[model samples]
Target: MYSKKVKLRFVFVIVFLILIVLTTFTVLKVLKDNVVYFKSPSEINLLSEISNKKIRVGGMVKKDSVMMNNNKINFIITDFKNELYVTFSGTVPNLFEEEKGVVAEGFLNDKKFLVADKILAKHDENYMPPEVKKSLGE
Candidate 1:
């Protein structure tokens, strides 16, 4: 047996709690869709199943693994234990080179290869873009 005012307050609190829970759930669901996991070539190669979801793969570009055909660029990322091939059509970063650190964002294909949408190159201090080097003639 609850009084009228007490029942109204209880109902208000329940509604507020439900709204908070719904809002929290919605935010987490949205964040989950945007989350991308970063993995190395060795880790990817060991997966039981290949996924087509977008992901970030980071490793050193293998020596003598870079090749260009027409406008497309193909390279192999290696963790020294395993290799993951990557295909990118757009212009690559200036520091992208064999034996250098690179991260590619893209989808995995049937051959466990990455079809890169973007390529990011990591370099040390004293690094220069090819365009800059060309303009400076060095």
Candidate 2:
């Protein structure tokens, strides 16, 4: 037979251990993997530090820089300081065009071209999405 004090202590220990496990799981699942990536060209120039990190790279599609051959489109995105070549084969957004804001999600290949897994077109200020605007720090 256990004393009242021992039963209370056992219950407290079980609850305390459960709380610790739950807190650790929540922090690892939500806080750790929910990182949002933001970058401009000059910032990306420092990519050697975050090169392996999946990130969001934003810049303007250079005017007359977009070239298309079949389903593939190649263009230069510039942040006014640096430029990166981007290649996307999927259907582009309606706003995707030369001299427009674009965010490409992917990794930089050995060829220096961004192999975009996703392409997002940034609209004008009056039409900007709240998330994109916030990402641009606007």
Candidate 3:
């Protein structure tokens, strides 16, 4: 039979281990909170309650909708059903053009424009990499 001291020590060790695990889990959860997720303009409605959070907006660059002013370029991204205005201040990607797919990363501004820090042009399905082409049976 274990002595009272040994029983007490065993309980203390188990409690200490559980506390350590909980503390580690809490710390990791806090860190993960800073990471943001991407969404389309149509998906924005699903996250209406979570405004002012950083996110990536992916959609087609609206045709004849890009307007330039000094260093800022304002454009509209559309997902066929919904659209969002976007403003970015940087050199556009090589593939960036009207009626092309684009993914902008930033947060929505007070004026409802997506202030993008970067823009990524999406490739066309007709000219995909070999792996993607094979996956789609193209």
Considering every candidate listed, which one attains the maximal lDDT?
1
Tens digit per residue, CA lDDT, model 1, 73-100: 9999988988899999989988899999
Tell me the lDDT of model 1 at 39.
83
The parts of candidate 1 lying over 4 Å away from their true place are 1-37, 124-138
Measured on C-alpha atoms, candidate 1 has an lDDT of 0.87
Give a tens-digit lDDT track for model 2, residues 26-127: 887796535544467676676555465556678899998999999998888898888888888888899898888999988876324678878999877676
Q: What is the lDDT for 17 in model 2?
A: 100
lDDT of 3 by residue, 16-132 (tens): 999999998898889763453456787775564657767788889999999999999999999888888999998999999999989999888733468899999988767667899
lDDT score of residue 103 within candidate 1: 94
Q: C-alpha displacement of 125 in model 3, angstroms?
A: 1.9
TM-score to native of every candidate shown: 0.61, 0.61, 0.61
* Two-way TM-score contest, 1 vs 2, winner: 1
Give the whole-model CA lDDT for all candidates, comma-separated: 0.87, 0.80, 0.84
Question: Among all windows of ten consecutive residues in candidate 1, which has the lowest summed lDDT?
Answer: 32-41
Q: Listing every candidate in turn, what is its Cα RMSD in Å to the true structure after a full C-alpha superposition?
A: 8.0, 8.0, 6.5
